[model samples]
Target: MHPDRYHVTLVLAGRPALHGWWGSEPIARAQFTGLVGRYGQPGTRITLVDEETGATLTEWPETS
Candidate 1:
C-alpha cells in the first residue's frame, strides 16, 4: 500500500494550519470529520484529498 496516500488539511485564516497524511481512506475520512467538528468555524477550511489520483475526497464549507 502506498504510504501517506490520503492527505488532509486544515486551513485557518487563509493559511494552512494543520495537515495529516494516511494510507487508508477510511481513516483519513474519519479524521476529516473530527477536524471539521474541532475546527469548523468561519474562515477555516478543511479538506481531504486522494493523493494517488489527485482527486478531492471531501471538504468542509464546500464550494458552490
Candidate 2:
C-alpha cells in the first residue's frame, strides 16, 4: 500500500464489516460511501477518527 493510504474500517457489533485504505481525502468520501453502501443497514452508525491525531472526525448514521 502507498504511504498516504489509510485503512478505514466499519465495526459492527464489535466485529469489522469492511476495511480498506483511502489514498486521499477526496477518495475518503467515496470510499466511505462504498463501504457503507455494502455493509451499512438500518441502525447502522459509523465513527470516523484519525489514528494519528486520535481525533474523532465524524460519527453518524452510515445508511442513506
- In order, what is each prediction's RMSD in angstroms? 0.6, 4.1
- Candidate with best lDDT: 1
lDDT of each: 0.96, 0.60
Backbone clash count for every predicted candidate, in the order shown: 0, 0
Residues 1-64 of candidate 2: C-alpha lDDT, one tens digit per residue: 3543444667777676666555565576677677677767765556555555556555547225
Q: How far is candidate 1 from the true structure (C-alpha RMSD, Å)?
A: 0.6
Give the residue spans of candidate 2 off by over 4 A.
42-45, 62-64
Misplaced by over 4 Å in model 1 are none
TM-score per prediction, in order, is 0.95, 0.56
Predicted candidate 1 versus true structure: per-residue lDDT over 1-64, tens digit per residue: 7999999999999999999999999999999999999999999999999999999999998988
Find the candidate with the highest TM-score and give its number.
1
